[model samples]
Target: MAAPAGDNVQLTDGEERAISSYFGFDCLYDHQRKVISDTLLSKDVFLSTKTSSGKSLCYQSIPVVYQHRQLPVIVLVISPLLSIMEEQVHLLRAMGFTATVIGKDPKENNDIKTGKYSFLYTNPETVLKDDEWREVLMTEVYRKTVRLIVVDEAHTVTQWGTSSTEEVFREWFGRLGELRSLLPGIPMLAITATATNINRRKIKQKLCMMNSIDYTESPDRNNISLFVSEIPHAKPLEEVFGWLVTAAKQNSCPRTVVFCKSIGDTAKVYGMFVRELAGCHREIVNMYHSCTLPNIKEKIRANMNDIDGSLQILICTNAAGMGVDFKGVQSVVNYGPPQELDTLIQQLGRAGRDGSQSLHILFYKNNK
Candidate 1:
């Protein structure tokens, strides 16, 4: 097996050029170069950087270098959100690379065994419970061709992915390490948008990466201004949004998102907005959560990407936290702060991804 690079820091000039050509970036920034460099040299890597900081590029560059040299290898990405997995595959395909998600398309399990792809994306449920993927990972073919196993949102493992099974869909993230025993010796890359020192240690420990390299970057988005307020606990739903509701009434709510810690809260908030803007609910606001149908989630995602797609304000739970590309957002509101600081940061990072100035306003009643 040609395992991922070891003991090599800087990518070779040729490797760098290939990555530049493939991703269309001029060259890697020092942060990316360092993280990718350490991944090449370490037994494993836990990358803690801010959102939209090209963390995906760190993992994707490995496969690009291998494929550029005509090496036949497959990189497996374990992402928590189905939407993000599909979005990742689409992004790779647009870059002229082959990528696919397991259990979500016309893809067959045999395709994985045959090495018909350069990248394979799957969620934890597929990894742990799905018989086909579990079986495929044990195959001689996978043992030989699979080069790296990447956990895209690494902090989730420490937060244990959405609190619990009933809370969100990331519980499998903490249990991800069990796979290391199944595919021993395959270098792993765990990347997250945010993690404290304690969170980082827990993540590395849970993933069986105690010996992993650590790369840390400031998880700050300078373009976005953050504001916190303690709203009256007994206030009406309309008081929460205040003037933003007026904009929703006028069909001019700048692309905004309200994130709730729970699905029930998300529904309540969505109902409030729908009641307040009954006629324009379809045009101005939409609800997203773990229980939302896949097709509806896709539609909501599409609307977010479309600047004029009508649905501007998104009412969602942490399900929208990981990697749904809702670019061009102008403001984000937290109905309340999440239990984990990492979750709040991830949720806040969703705004201003396009580098536009944005706002992250948290309305709370009590101390968290």
Candidate 2:
């Protein structure tokens, strides 16, 4: 592990060169470069960079340089949502990396045990539940194989409150000591796109990761336009109706994602799609959320990918936005405001992944 020289905290020449080569970029955003170099020195880092700002590169680069001259059994990425895990695996595989998903894709369980992958992404809850996986993870094979443990969406673990089940909280509630006993001196990295002051402290305490540093990139997107509408006793359905009408009349064909705040809201939005869009209005659209059956959700996701303009309007909740990609989605309609600004940003981020002009509109009503 290398240390930052002198009082200057800038990346060393070697670190800069390595990052540039791996990501095919001239330089890391100041935040990304710092986190990467700091983690390379074996320091645990907690960061709040925006989605698609290259936070994954922090750990992705770490394994390349700090694997101790041995192939890491795998880099374990603990993500909170299935959408994010699925999206990450897709992105990593596209990059020509040997990334395997443990929680999803059951067939890959055997592959994980064979230690054939460079990265294994799973949720913390899943990691703790299966004693069999835990046993292997505690073994020398895993010790030599895993170079770093990454906690993506680390804020969720703390802000959502700790689970009573040990398996779910094992990684957070002081169980790291036991695991560290087996694989002594392995580094941990906790990454999030948003963390309040309290969330930051809870993350360090829960993960038992000391000497932690935080990196936050400004949440400003010059290309993105933001609008917030505050209404009193606002009917969310009516909001969606107006947004769709306005969008449909726009000069350009812009895809839109309508985000509801709850499952019940999702039902209403889905119904609105069928009644307002598909039935009376004759609009082509689809709906998705966790409450939807798995098969149904799959069909919706597949439908959204139709490049020939088969699927145009997507009505969903936060459940569908995590890592799912809907290319050329130019607009995101928030039927109801998100609980937090960070979540709002993540949901809005799905629209602009293609770097095109994206629009985020929030509709909120003050019941009081």
Candidate 3:
């Protein structure tokens, strides 16, 4: 498959392409075209698609047409992981497109001026901390320039809807409503790879979307296999550690990922891997839970991307799973069952991405 066209992907009618050149393809994948067409027609769209299924391209194409019209297109993508947002910014910049991330650096007191960025990536926490971001978007300078707002990982906002911070949720909800009101008839696109039906409904209502169309493809990747095993209920940590050692021996330098349910579990798995397997391989094996300091987190993400080997295992909590692309990850070991199937599916999707036969395993201590 050829690389997707640069930001130069042509726009037709000064709005969208004739369903061909914009996507750099002779034709749109049945689902891809559906989303692109619906969004251009001023409809709110929710899409759940498989890994590597061109979800980003759907919303991304909107900016091209909007940009061509000199409408000053701005796409707001809400993602939870700071690392993921940074990675996206890097890609966009590499492609010679203007992208920006607000609230990541407190020192960046630069003007929140509208039209400065074509695509903006941010998290809910980032938005909550910086109320000025919303104000900027609501201002007259921004309203006339901005054409669309995209909510990536739309599920996170749904979780926030019923969170303990009622005031904050109300504020966010109101702001989103105000955004819609401010940019009436401007298209909004919420894209996620995994979402429950209830959460999906909440997202539409909370985001103040009307006549929203939902598009989804299963997260399950059948090319990857699943295995589950139960051990003594005690020492689930020890059980996971032992399994990692064995899995390391099975393949030749396989890139593996071990996902735990919480920050504490991420710590436990990392301790076991470091203490037990340190100095065993030339390839670096690292930990990636959320509690790590910001500087350390940046370093860990950088190292993981540069490292190559089957023995490289990134032990972390659910934080690393969503939209953080890892190429050639050959195995995904769940230290225990995740709280939900969507999580399990997302974590496993990271594996076998290179189309190699990958392994997915779940290990738990047996109670019997």
Candidate 4:
């Protein structure tokens, strides 16, 4: 394995050129540069940064740097969402890199076994359930081609992994700790957009990271103006919809995402929006949830990211947000208070990604 350079060493000409040519960036952010340098030096990294903080680049740049040096190294990215995994693969391929998502196609899996791909994107569920894929990963690790393992939404290990109520999460995410055992001595990188101090500690413990370098940035979104409204519990849906419609009209049809607590509520809210818009605006509205078919979910995601597409508004549950990038989302409306502060911060991070002034509205029901 190729070791990382010293922390104080400047990027080489080749590394600088790779960033410029591949990502179209003249220079990396200070944090990105530091993390990449540290990781290359064989350090485990725990990056707890805000959304759009260039965390992905910190890990993404490492493989490119290694490949540029003619060192054969592959990265295994443990992504939580299919949407995020798909987007990462798409972006990497567009940049002329060999990247593929696991279980999407037989040929992709074959490529992994044959050492054809440089980056492999997968989820914990697939890793735990599929024997063939697991075998291929083990083979690659044994051969030392898989140099780094990145856990994208590291907070999920604490949020879902430790949940006493969700057995599926416990069974899948709980087993993530075993990765350290499976491939000892390999550098691990864990990243999340939102995590409290306690959550951060739990993530490191659950992943069994040793002597990890931790990086954190404030979660505040200065470009987003947040507002919370208390409403009557009875018929709160009408108030939420009314506020959203009025806000949309006032904001001149800006891209918006309405988050609900349940899939049923997501569908109901989407239907209500369709009924209310009822014309030209209706074409821009849609809903996304886990229950939605994969093809339809893909379409929804594509449309949301499309700057020119008619689809501008999405009614979704928390399933739509984490690590899923949607540019130019001007507003994020929560149907009610989120169950926790981390979730609220994650949802709010969706908007204002473009650095334009955006809005985050939270509706809280009056207990009385």
Candidate 5:
């Protein structure tokens, strides 16, 4: 996999070869090349691209570029979901890159202090409150070799960070502002799959990136056909159950995800399917939420990704959908309206990721 001719000039010959080989792509998408080129030139960048648009490549390429230079450069990625952080670390390690997720383990501390890892992944709370990790960051090795900092799911800085109701998120994510003051010159990259104009402005302000370059693409998924319907208040559950049965039974739409607002609803929907869809469909149904055990969650994610597996349908809360890529999901059923429009878009983006035609159905109770 060689880089295409006349690609961005900022990438050195070694860096270009590394990107091409690591990703198995002859050339990066135009936007990805621009991001890597700009970040290499020491510019702040905010990417508001669609899901599955190769946004991670924009920042992931940074460490590879520096690693090619035979430098001890490290890239710190602040991600919100433990699942996402773990997944990225696993992929990098599989690619023969030294990457670690921040944890309470003493070995992680030693690894950081010795400058043995090329990439570190952690959440905002861990970096802000962990005394040992903070000390590691302040060390001369980190101060000198750390080349880039990435904020994945940057929309959360406003959606969750400043929530008037979620005190925990505010307390933790609010500290993002201090990052600029702590590491003044290192380039910051904020990437999210969905963001409104207002959210874009808020994210830049909260992250203290007034001079950041902005890249945006429409959030529309043309392959996903959207449908909205109002169910009678008294029979909303029955209506939803029937729809799920029909959708799963349709051979054209085999893989499906039903997003409920609460864990209780997820359990109820899952139980109903287990009891009602008594044959092959019953065997394929499962539930996922924050309370689902980590091991079970991992298995569920793996099964969802197995195109040939019996696990074809998953009823889950919002937590189940974030940053977890399931490429075979052909249908997304929203049990009710999403809390907000951006959330709706994110959930819908999960389906049809393989670029095949998909369905997104939204069901709401009629107020009348």
Candidate 6:
């Protein structure tokens, strides 16, 4: 959903009630209402706003509206991470919406073809490469009933498009535009929290959304306070992290996520905490990166989403912090100044998502 590209961006009485009742909100924000209205007209939308700003509701409400009118419509959501798809599908089911990931849920495959799910969540790879998914998209049922295609964390289309790392590790991100021909004439809703003018241009080009309606909001979270400090690397390790170590000892450290630049840094930091905390490291901390096992990553995700879970501190690279909404991360620590501004904004945006007062502390080392 986004700003109106055409006239008459108004929601019908039934549509408005469907949105508010299902999401349990008194009223929709101005941007939200504008997005939902524009989307109803089947307009492309690029929504760039801060995290926790109800971006999910923008696209989620579309199928809700169609369902209310007794229309059999499905929204295809192409997300970056499987964890993100799984997490959102779970929440959607809890909210009484029919949504499911295509793969990994073998039992749901038949249901998906029957158009039982209002939303189908899958990665770009499956969208571009999977033969079975290709056949499903070609079916008369999908072509007639699939009204919209959503690209979540859409900034990655641009971020990965020009990166050499993608060529070696995963090239499916850069090729997301191919979905356009597969699902011709269907509008796309691209949502992200960390795209600038340059990034937006690239994303639009990558997704072939040159005429997409734009809904830009100030990327500000009022409850988050930011501070940057220089770390004297010459000092002993104990002197640098001793404060957190002590806080961990008292079991008073707030739920925190430490963003390191490299997987090795995550491991090093995770080891330090484990060593200082004695035998309780397993109960207090964990590390995540691209190399982490799938089951372990799922477990870590579960723990992070549980406010009362034993694992509290997470040290990881860029892998774990993308689009999933962790339960309550009160503190965000960037181990070093990220080379890119969007990365910094995204990492810090993870805080205050639960609406609690949060802190973003970045520690950098001098080059000289």
Highest lDDT among the candidates is held by which one?
6
Model 4: how far residue 274 lies from native, Å: 1.8
Best candidate (score: TM-score)? 5
Question: RMSD per prediction, one decimal?
Answer: 2.8, 4.9, 5.6, 2.7, 4.4, 3.3
Of the candidates numbered 1 and 6, which has the greater TM-score value?
Answer: 6
Candidate 3, residues 1-368, lDDT tens digits: the string is 11112222333443445434554566557787777667656667888887778788776666666656545666777766777788888977776567878765655535446467777787654554466775665666556655557887666665544565455443353245455754566667888777777767777887787688889766878778889877566654655466566655454457888888888878777777666665654245677776778787777676656545233778888778877777678788887888666677778888887677888988876668
Off by over 4 Å in 1: 1-10, 105-107, 161-171, 280-282, 366-368
After superposing candidate 5 on the true structure, give the runs of residues whose Cα lies further than 4 Å from its correct spot: 1-9, 165-170, 247-253
lDDT of each: 0.81, 0.68, 0.68, 0.80, 0.81, 0.83
Question: Model 6 misses residue 54 by how many Å?
Answer: 0.4
Q: Model 6, residue 67: what's the lDDT?
A: 70
Tens-place lDDT digits, model 2, residues 106-127: 7877778777788888765566
Please write out the lDDT profile of model 6 over residues 80-196, one tens digit for every residue.
888788889998899888989987778888988888889999988886889898788877777777877899988788676557543634578788888888777778899999888
Residue 215 in candidate 4, Cα distance off native in Å: 0.6
lDDT of model 2 at position 97: 75
Between 3 and 6, whose lDDT is larger? 6
What total of clashing residue pairs does each candidate reach?
Answer: 0, 4, 8, 2, 0, 0
Residues 149-204, model 4: lDDT tens digits: 89998878877777756554545775687777656567789999889988888788
Segments of candidate 3 deviating more than 4 angstroms: 1-27, 104-111, 125-129, 163-178, 235-239, 247-253, 306-311, 366-368
- The 10-residue segment of model 3 with minimum total lDDT is 1-10
Model 2 CA deviation exceeding 4 Å by range: 1-23, 66-73, 103-111, 163-183, 232-240, 249-253, 279-283, 299-309, 354-356
Residue 359 lDDT (model 1): 94
